[model samples]
Target: MVTKSDTNSVQVEIVPSRFLMPETAQRLLCEIYKNGGIRRIMIHGPNMPREVPYGPGKGIPIEANRNLLVEIGDQAIELRVKVGRIRLEMESEDYLGGLKAACERALPFSFQFRQGKFFHDRMTTSDYAKYGKVEDERILGLIDPKAKKDKLAILSEDMVTFKEDEER
Candidate 1:
Protein backbone atom coordinates (compact mmCIF):
# COMPACT_ATOMS: atom_id res chain seq x y z
CA MET A 1 0.00 0.00 0.00
CA VAL A 2 1.15 3.56 -0.59
CA THR A 3 1.93 4.81 2.89
CA LYS A 4 1.67 8.53 3.56
CA SER A 5 0.43 10.89 6.21
CA ASP A 6 -3.29 11.57 5.51
CA THR A 7 -3.65 13.72 8.61
CA ASN A 8 -3.21 16.85 6.55
CA SER A 9 -4.72 15.35 3.44
CA VAL A 10 -7.69 17.02 1.78
CA GLN A 11 -10.52 15.15 0.06
CA VAL A 12 -12.07 16.57 -3.08
CA GLU A 13 -15.27 14.99 -4.32
CA ILE A 14 -16.17 15.50 -7.97
CA VAL A 15 -19.73 14.64 -9.00
CA PRO A 16 -20.42 14.95 -12.68
CA SER A 17 -23.82 16.07 -13.94
CA ARG A 18 -24.13 12.89 -15.95
CA PHE A 19 -22.44 9.49 -16.22
CA LEU A 20 -19.03 9.92 -17.82
CA MET A 21 -17.93 8.06 -20.91
CA PRO A 22 -14.76 5.98 -20.87
CA GLU A 23 -12.83 8.47 -22.96
CA THR A 24 -13.99 11.41 -20.90
CA ALA A 25 -13.03 9.71 -17.65
CA GLN A 26 -9.64 8.80 -19.03
CA ARG A 27 -9.03 12.33 -20.16
CA LEU A 28 -10.09 13.76 -16.79
CA LEU A 29 -7.92 11.31 -14.84
CA CYS A 30 -4.90 12.15 -16.95
CA GLU A 31 -5.52 15.82 -16.44
CA ILE A 32 -5.77 15.40 -12.67
CA TYR A 33 -2.57 13.36 -12.43
CA LYS A 34 -0.80 15.84 -14.64
CA ASN A 35 -1.74 18.64 -12.26
CA GLY A 36 0.07 16.64 -9.52
CA GLY A 37 -0.30 16.59 -5.69
CA ILE A 38 -2.85 13.79 -5.84
CA ARG A 39 -2.24 11.08 -3.24
CA ARG A 40 -5.12 8.74 -4.15
CA ILE A 41 -8.18 8.67 -6.40
CA MET A 42 -11.37 6.63 -6.05
CA ILE A 43 -13.96 6.43 -8.79
CA HIS A 44 -17.48 5.43 -7.80
CA GLY A 45 -20.48 4.64 -9.97
CA PRO A 46 -22.95 1.94 -10.99
CA ASN A 47 -21.32 -1.49 -11.21
CA MET A 48 -20.58 -2.83 -14.67
CA PRO A 49 -19.93 -6.56 -14.78
CA ARG A 50 -17.83 -8.41 -17.31
CA GLU A 51 -20.57 -11.03 -17.61
CA VAL A 52 -24.29 -11.36 -17.21
CA PRO A 53 -25.00 -12.28 -13.60
CA TYR A 54 -28.52 -13.73 -13.88
CA GLY A 55 -31.19 -15.12 -16.24
CA PRO A 56 -30.57 -17.52 -19.17
CA GLY A 57 -27.42 -15.68 -20.19
CA LYS A 58 -26.19 -15.52 -16.60
CA GLY A 59 -22.95 -17.29 -17.37
CA ILE A 60 -22.24 -15.47 -20.61
CA PRO A 61 -19.62 -12.75 -20.99
CA ILE A 62 -20.95 -9.27 -21.50
CA GLU A 63 -20.10 -7.40 -24.68
CA ALA A 64 -19.69 -4.02 -23.08
CA ASN A 65 -18.61 -1.04 -25.20
CA ARG A 66 -18.05 1.45 -22.40
CA ASN A 67 -14.91 0.00 -20.84
CA LEU A 68 -12.05 2.51 -20.76
CA LEU A 69 -8.29 2.43 -21.20
CA VAL A 70 -7.00 5.28 -19.05
CA GLU A 71 -3.37 6.33 -19.08
CA ILE A 72 -1.91 7.87 -15.93
CA GLY A 73 1.60 9.10 -16.64
CA ASP A 74 3.12 6.08 -18.40
CA GLN A 75 0.84 3.48 -16.78
CA ALA A 76 -2.32 2.26 -18.49
CA ILE A 77 -5.36 1.77 -16.28
CA GLU A 78 -8.70 0.15 -16.98
CA LEU A 79 -11.87 1.85 -15.87
CA ARG A 80 -14.79 -0.57 -15.47
CA VAL A 81 -17.66 1.71 -14.61
CA LYS A 82 -19.60 4.63 -16.05
CA VAL A 83 -18.00 7.10 -13.69
CA GLY A 84 -20.35 9.18 -11.55
CA ARG A 85 -18.43 10.59 -8.62
CA ILE A 86 -14.68 10.83 -8.20
CA ARG A 87 -13.11 11.23 -4.77
CA LEU A 88 -9.51 12.38 -4.64
CA GLU A 89 -7.07 12.74 -1.77
CA MET A 90 -4.38 15.36 -2.08
CA GLU A 91 -1.19 15.69 -0.07
CA SER A 92 -2.25 19.10 1.21
CA GLU A 93 -4.93 21.76 0.78
CA ASP A 94 -2.67 23.90 -1.38
CA TYR A 95 -3.35 21.84 -4.50
CA LEU A 96 -7.08 22.58 -4.56
CA GLY A 97 -6.87 25.40 -7.10
CA GLY A 98 -4.88 23.39 -9.61
CA LEU A 99 -7.13 20.38 -9.15
CA LYS A 100 -10.24 22.44 -9.67
CA ALA A 101 -8.79 24.00 -12.80
CA ALA A 102 -7.89 20.59 -14.14
CA CYS A 103 -11.38 19.33 -13.46
CA GLU A 104 -12.96 22.29 -15.21
CA ARG A 105 -10.80 21.75 -18.28
CA ALA A 106 -11.22 18.01 -18.52
CA LEU A 107 -14.90 17.57 -17.64
CA PRO A 108 -17.23 18.93 -20.28
CA PHE A 109 -20.32 18.40 -18.14
CA SER A 110 -21.07 20.30 -14.96
CA PHE A 111 -19.45 18.99 -11.77
CA GLN A 112 -19.41 19.72 -8.06
CA PHE A 113 -16.36 19.74 -5.80
CA ARG A 114 -16.65 19.36 -2.06
CA GLN A 115 -13.94 19.06 0.57
CA GLY A 116 -14.27 16.52 3.37
CA LYS A 117 -13.19 13.02 4.44
CA PHE A 118 -14.77 10.50 2.06
CA PHE A 119 -12.63 7.46 2.93
CA HIS A 120 -12.42 5.37 6.07
CA ASP A 121 -10.27 7.00 8.74
CA ARG A 122 -10.17 4.37 11.46
CA MET A 123 -9.48 0.65 11.71
CA THR A 124 -12.46 -1.64 11.74
CA THR A 125 -13.01 -5.08 13.34
CA SER A 126 -11.87 -6.90 10.20
CA ASP A 127 -8.70 -4.79 10.00
CA TYR A 128 -7.78 -5.51 13.62
CA ALA A 129 -8.34 -9.24 13.19
CA LYS A 130 -6.38 -9.43 9.94
CA TYR A 131 -3.49 -7.05 10.65
CA GLY A 132 -3.74 -6.27 14.37
CA LYS A 133 -3.46 -2.79 15.85
CA VAL A 134 -1.49 -0.52 13.56
CA GLU A 135 0.22 2.64 14.64
CA ASP A 136 -0.25 4.42 11.34
CA GLU A 137 -3.74 5.83 10.98
CA ARG A 138 -3.18 6.00 7.23
CA ILE A 139 -3.24 2.19 7.12
CA LEU A 140 -6.41 1.92 9.19
CA GLY A 141 -8.92 2.19 6.36
CA LEU A 142 -10.92 -0.27 4.21
CA ILE A 143 -8.01 -0.85 1.82
CA ASP A 144 -5.40 -3.41 2.86
CA PRO A 145 -2.33 -1.64 4.17
CA LYS A 146 -0.11 -4.55 3.21
CA ALA A 147 -1.49 -4.78 -0.31
CA LYS A 148 0.78 -4.25 -3.29
CA LYS A 149 -0.40 -0.72 -4.04
CA ASP A 150 -2.89 1.68 -2.56
CA LYS A 151 -4.81 3.51 -5.31
CA LEU A 152 -3.23 3.00 -8.71
CA ALA A 153 -3.89 0.08 -11.07
CA ILE A 154 -1.82 -1.05 -14.04
CA LEU A 155 -3.97 -2.55 -16.78
CA SER A 156 -3.25 -4.44 -19.98
CA GLU A 157 -4.14 -3.12 -23.42
CA ASP A 158 -7.22 -5.31 -23.81
CA MET A 159 -9.89 -3.83 -21.55
CA VAL A 160 -12.36 -6.74 -21.72
CA THR A 161 -12.00 -10.43 -20.92
CA PHE A 162 -14.32 -13.39 -21.39
CA LYS A 163 -15.03 -15.92 -18.67
CA GLU A 164 -14.75 -19.62 -19.45
CA ASP A 165 -18.05 -21.46 -19.74
CA GLU A 166 -17.34 -23.67 -16.74
CA GLU A 167 -16.11 -20.82 -14.48
CA ARG A 168 -19.40 -19.02 -14.91
Candidate 2:
Protein backbone atom coordinates (compact mmCIF):
# COMPACT_ATOMS: atom_id res chain seq x y z
CA MET A 1 0.00 0.00 0.00
CA VAL A 2 1.43 3.35 -1.07
CA THR A 3 0.85 5.95 1.60
CA LYS A 4 1.27 9.69 1.11
CA SER A 5 4.61 9.67 2.93
CA ASP A 6 5.78 6.75 0.79
CA THR A 7 5.28 8.73 -2.41
CA ASN A 8 8.31 10.55 -3.81
CA SER A 9 6.47 12.87 -6.15
CA VAL A 10 5.99 16.54 -5.31
CA GLN A 11 2.98 18.63 -6.26
CA VAL A 12 3.15 22.30 -7.08
CA GLU A 13 0.55 25.03 -7.33
CA ILE A 14 1.11 28.38 -9.06
CA VAL A 15 -1.30 31.25 -8.61
CA PRO A 16 -0.55 34.36 -10.58
CA SER A 17 -1.45 37.81 -9.34
CA ARG A 18 -3.87 38.06 -12.25
CA PHE A 19 -5.45 35.62 -14.67
CA LEU A 20 -3.11 34.72 -17.47
CA MET A 21 -3.89 35.76 -21.02
CA PRO A 22 -3.88 32.95 -23.56
CA GLU A 23 -0.53 34.00 -25.01
CA THR A 24 1.08 34.18 -21.58
CA ALA A 25 -0.41 30.86 -20.54
CA GLN A 26 0.90 29.28 -23.72
CA ARG A 27 4.39 30.57 -23.13
CA LEU A 28 4.36 29.42 -19.49
CA LEU A 29 3.07 25.94 -20.35
CA CYS A 30 5.57 25.57 -23.17
CA GLU A 31 8.45 26.49 -20.89
CA ILE A 32 7.33 24.07 -18.16
CA TYR A 33 6.93 21.22 -20.68
CA LYS A 34 10.41 21.87 -21.97
CA ASN A 35 11.77 21.15 -18.48
CA GLY A 36 10.53 17.55 -18.78
CA GLY A 37 9.64 16.54 -15.20
CA ILE A 38 5.92 17.13 -15.10
CA ARG A 39 3.87 13.98 -14.58
CA ARG A 40 0.48 15.67 -14.63
CA ILE A 41 -0.77 19.23 -14.97
CA MET A 42 -4.15 20.93 -14.59
CA ILE A 43 -5.33 24.49 -15.07
CA HIS A 44 -8.10 26.23 -13.15
CA GLY A 45 -10.21 29.36 -13.36
CA PRO A 46 -13.75 30.61 -13.88
CA ASN A 47 -15.50 29.17 -16.91
CA MET A 48 -16.18 31.57 -19.73
CA PRO A 49 -19.79 31.14 -20.77
CA ARG A 50 -20.14 30.13 -24.41
CA GLU A 51 -23.45 31.92 -24.62
CA VAL A 52 -25.26 34.44 -22.48
CA PRO A 53 -27.02 32.10 -20.07
CA TYR A 54 -29.76 34.65 -19.24
CA GLY A 55 -30.77 38.31 -19.36
CA PRO A 56 -31.33 40.32 -22.56
CA GLY A 57 -28.77 38.37 -24.58
CA LYS A 58 -29.99 34.90 -23.66
CA GLY A 59 -28.70 32.20 -26.05
CA ILE A 60 -26.52 34.68 -27.89
CA PRO A 61 -22.90 33.71 -28.45
CA ILE A 62 -20.51 35.73 -26.38
CA GLU A 63 -16.97 36.71 -27.27
CA ALA A 64 -15.01 36.41 -24.02
CA ASN A 65 -11.72 37.52 -25.62
CA ARG A 66 -10.04 34.30 -24.59
CA ASN A 67 -7.73 32.84 -27.22
CA LEU A 68 -8.95 29.29 -26.39
CA LEU A 69 -6.10 27.80 -28.44
CA VAL A 70 -2.54 27.33 -27.30
CA GLU A 71 0.24 25.09 -28.49
CA ILE A 72 2.58 23.09 -26.25
CA GLY A 73 5.22 20.82 -27.71
CA ASP A 74 3.60 21.68 -31.05
CA GLN A 75 0.24 20.21 -29.97
CA ALA A 76 -2.68 22.61 -30.01
CA ILE A 77 -5.06 22.49 -27.04
CA GLU A 78 -8.29 24.30 -26.41
CA LEU A 79 -8.56 25.79 -22.94
CA ARG A 80 -12.10 25.88 -21.60
CA VAL A 81 -11.29 27.94 -18.53
CA LYS A 82 -9.71 31.32 -18.03
CA VAL A 83 -6.36 30.29 -16.51
CA GLY A 84 -5.85 31.74 -13.02
CA ARG A 85 -3.86 29.00 -11.38
CA ILE A 86 -1.87 25.95 -12.40
CA ARG A 87 -1.37 22.76 -10.40
CA LEU A 88 1.06 20.06 -11.42
CA GLU A 89 2.64 16.90 -10.12
CA MET A 90 6.33 16.39 -10.62
CA GLU A 91 8.48 13.29 -10.31
CA SER A 92 10.56 15.08 -7.71
CA GLU A 93 11.60 18.47 -6.36
CA ASP A 94 14.80 18.51 -8.43
CA TYR A 95 12.96 20.30 -11.22
CA LEU A 96 11.38 23.01 -9.09
CA GLY A 97 14.21 25.44 -9.77
CA GLY A 98 13.79 25.11 -13.48
CA LEU A 99 10.06 25.55 -13.11
CA LYS A 100 10.60 28.76 -11.10
CA ALA A 101 12.92 30.10 -13.77
CA ALA A 102 10.39 29.30 -16.46
CA CYS A 103 7.72 31.18 -14.55
CA GLU A 104 9.99 34.14 -14.01
CA ARG A 105 10.69 34.39 -17.72
CA ALA A 106 7.10 33.88 -18.81
CA LEU A 107 5.14 35.90 -16.24
CA PRO A 108 5.54 39.65 -16.15
CA PHE A 109 3.82 39.97 -12.75
CA SER A 110 4.06 38.32 -9.34
CA PHE A 111 2.86 34.79 -8.70
CA GLN A 112 2.83 32.35 -5.82
CA PHE A 113 4.51 28.95 -6.05
CA ARG A 114 3.59 26.45 -3.40
CA GLN A 115 4.34 22.78 -2.73
CA GLY A 116 1.72 20.51 -1.25
CA LYS A 117 -0.74 17.73 -1.99
CA PHE A 118 -2.96 19.63 -4.41
CA PHE A 119 -4.15 16.52 -6.32
CA HIS A 120 -6.04 13.43 -5.29
CA ASP A 121 -3.53 10.87 -4.02
CA ARG A 122 -5.75 7.88 -4.67
CA MET A 123 -8.34 7.03 -7.26
CA THR A 124 -11.96 7.16 -6.16
CA THR A 125 -14.96 5.06 -7.20
CA SER A 126 -16.03 7.76 -9.60
CA ASP A 127 -12.64 7.57 -11.30
CA TYR A 128 -12.84 3.80 -11.64
CA ALA A 129 -16.38 4.08 -12.93
CA LYS A 130 -15.31 6.61 -15.50
CA TYR A 131 -11.91 5.31 -16.57
CA GLY A 132 -12.22 1.66 -15.51
CA LYS A 133 -9.25 0.57 -13.46
CA VAL A 134 -6.80 3.08 -14.86
CA GLU A 135 -3.19 1.88 -14.57
CA ASP A 136 -1.68 5.33 -14.92
CA GLU A 137 -1.95 7.15 -11.62
CA ARG A 138 -0.72 10.31 -13.28
CA ILE A 139 -3.95 10.55 -15.25
CA LEU A 140 -6.35 10.00 -12.36
CA GLY A 141 -8.44 13.01 -11.31
CA LEU A 142 -7.12 15.00 -14.28
CA ILE A 143 -10.30 14.75 -16.32
CA ASP A 144 -13.93 15.55 -15.81
CA PRO A 145 -15.89 12.30 -15.67
CA LYS A 146 -19.05 14.01 -16.83
CA ALA A 147 -17.47 15.36 -19.99
CA LYS A 148 -17.93 13.36 -23.17
CA LYS A 149 -14.16 13.11 -23.57
CA ASP A 150 -11.09 13.62 -21.47
CA LYS A 151 -9.24 16.93 -21.76
CA LEU A 152 -5.87 15.33 -21.01
CA ALA A 153 -3.15 15.63 -23.66
CA ILE A 154 0.30 14.13 -24.07
CA LEU A 155 2.85 16.60 -25.30
CA SER A 156 5.43 13.89 -25.78
CA GLU A 157 5.74 10.61 -23.93
CA ASP A 158 9.46 10.71 -24.32
CA MET A 159 9.58 14.00 -22.48
CA VAL A 160 8.45 12.48 -19.19
CA THR A 161 10.35 9.17 -19.45
CA PHE A 162 13.72 10.81 -19.12
CA LYS A 163 15.23 13.99 -17.70
CA GLU A 164 16.50 16.53 -20.19
CA ASP A 165 19.91 18.16 -19.88
CA GLU A 166 19.81 21.07 -17.39
CA GLU A 167 21.29 23.53 -19.85
CA ARG A 168 18.58 26.09 -19.36
lDDT for each residue of candidate 1 in 1-168, tens digit (9 for 90 to 100): 967763787888999899998878888888988887766666777767678879988968876733456666776555666789888778888999999999899998789999987868777786677667766454333244333333323222222121221000
- Model 2 weakest 10-residue run by lDDT: 159-168
**What is the overall TM-score of model 1 with all chains considered together?**
0.73
Q: Each candidate's root-mean-square deviation in Å?
A: 7.9, 6.4
Question: How accurate locally, in lDDT, is each candidate?
Answer: 0.68, 0.74
Clashes of each: 0, 0
Q: Give candidate 1's root-mean-square deviation (CA, Å).
A: 7.9
Could you tell me which residue pairs clash in candidate 1? none
lDDT of 1: 0.68
Error at 58, model 1, angstroms: 0.9
Cα-based lDDT at residue 138, candidate 1: 46
Candidate 2 regions off by >4 Å? 1-4, 65-67, 129-132, 144-168
